[model samples]
Target: MTSTAAPDRPATQPRAPRRRALAERLLDTPLADALAGPHTVDHYLEILRPDWAVKRVRGEILDVRHQNEDSVTLTLRPTVTWPGFQAGQHVELSVDVDGVRHRRCYSPSGSADHRTRTVELTIRVHPQGVVSRHLKAHARRGMFVGLSLPRGEEFVLPTPRPRRVVLISGGSGITPVLSMLRTLTDEGHRGEIVFLHYVRGPRELLHADDLAAIEAAHDNVTVLRVATREAGELPTGWLSGRFGPEHLRRALPEDADAAAFVCGPGALVESVREAFREGGLTTPLRYEHFAPPELPEMDPDQLGTVTFAASDQQVEGDGRPLLEQAEAAGLRPEHGCRMGICMSCKCRLQHGQVRDTLTGEIHGTPGAEIRICVAAAVGDVTVEL
Candidate 1:
């Protein structure tokens, strides 16, 4: 698992020759970003498979691109088909290494409509892992890649209009929230929506203008950002002092039975859910999570027992992967965001058990398991999520 927010490596290491410095910059005041200036389809395609027609490339590097070196915006391209997306859904990507495949999930940036031909991804990359590393290293345009059906309903649209919609997201976990935010506007959203998002630096914020534009276009829309790392960073339009239950309540309108879409770190989601519950805002708060609940790490020795539900077959492996192990045993499972964010391959445990390597907890739900992309196996576990 563990994919979100890449660490800064020493500049001494090898890096692609970038026209820009590729560093984070602050938004003292809203400033126009050059990266967002303009780019063509050909420009992005040549980023990997030089031959635009030959979109199949193995080492396509979809590096975590920001609006600028210091901007907070992150961008990516979706690798699937169309209508392209009607807003508020996810796409699963398959990362194959040495014939072993891993599923990684990402919320499409938005619908690939008649206006825009490319689907964008606004993700904070994780330094380690299969897809993240590959994307950070070789996700170039024009490279043919495997993708899954778009999935998820976290950002359900409100009918005709709503009092408002409040979006709460933390860290690089702003993907789904952004999609919903833009959806409201692009679809000629007539209702009001408030966005309370968290990012460490203003420079790292994703889609600055998009959010600003939404706020500007509609008198009903309000955009607020929080920077946890800054002390005197007084962002002009911040809603809460920090992100949490308290911040959410303060950010939304009082009488507004606003639709709420929440995304980000699992801990933040749990906390916000509990916080909102306490606040009596029980309107089924929509949430998106890319990771299983964080728990203690499990021992590798215990990660070799799993019984597939479809095949009625039991399999054991060397802490390799639940999806991989399943596939090796002739079971093809659906997956994306193999690191855990996508939630594409989540299944329920019909019987038996499983243990997560990164997060130590043995699955809690006996019937409903977890995203298979993130778990291995343990004690002849049976999976049904």
Candidate 2:
């Protein structure tokens, strides 16, 4: 008694035409075409990427040097750079821990010897730090990680500012300040500059030899380190421990008015900025907000579906960040400092609006978007990924 037609075949459903890739969209959308041009396709391809999908080995770990009990220096093999970085710039290290994608932005512990393409990172291990712990415990030679080209404008020397410059850093925040000092000295870039760094003890210091060599070679460059555990007079030998607005002022040249660069954690950076302002510093002040520890307080469970888009990819992080989940899924997006301070991970927003933690602006780029790190889904959404 079976029907000859096989009991009515399921109605055939037609597959909707595939939407164009972001590169194709740029070519099709005249507005975006004019803005980004034929180069837009390349730009889209370059920016819209999954961390694992497009990430390639830039270099292998050359060697590991221990700074003290909890600090280590990793020397990387040769890397490639395009559009040479300015005197003061930074690089983003893309790493993975137990299948979870994590990115950390570390300032060069070495100099701008691009020929070698080798950079060193002085990492102080935090008990709860993700990347630091993983690298300190497991990373080894020949292990490869993705690194975004060097970036950051906040560290650049100002042309209109006074010749005298004062650099301030605390704890393990001396990385970028070290880069700036080395660049200036290595290139004979002149102007009186003094670096004031604060640390817990001398043993935890980074690049002691390099810093000393710079100070000795350059008459205009001075290095002052405040090691709290130094049981002696104020920084008599290679290091010392004293840092604050008072110390900063004392270290400056006769020209009290000079550009001041600062780096470190949020509270430290804010405190230094306030102190500098209170001192009536008219010179251009710049700062780099170091990578922050993951906030366990962020409860993605409370959120609804979050949608996001990029050039060549699309992503959804359920109620969380598309970038994070996408990274977990092995998509490598170009990002510098994931704190949303550097904006290197900016992406296109094709669908739902998002609220940015840094700016608190509701964003839906239509075909554009905001940085992925500090943004959250406001509602059900779709993105170019």
Cα lDDT tens digits, model 1, 111-201, are 4334654556654456556665665555454454555555655455555546677778886667677777777766666666778887766
Instruction: List, in order, the clash count of every candidate structure.
Output: 43, 18
lDDT of each: 0.61, 0.66
Q: Cα deviation of 79 in candidate 1 (Å)?
A: 9.7
Off by over 4 Å in 1: 1-65, 68-81, 94-103, 111-117, 239-241, 296-334, 339-351, 354-371, 374-385
TM-score for each of the candidates: 0.63, 0.62
Which ten residues in a row are the worst by lDDT in model 2? Answer: 49-58
Q: Report the error of model 1 at residue 298, Å.
A: 7.8
Q: What tens-digit string does per-residue lDDT give for candidate 2 at 263-300?
A: 77665676677766787766667886664433333346
Could you say which candidate leads in TM-score?
1
Question: RMSD of model 2, in Å?
Answer: 17.7
Q: Residue 345 of model 2: what lDDT?
A: 81
- Model 1 Cα shift for residue 242 (angstroms): 3.2
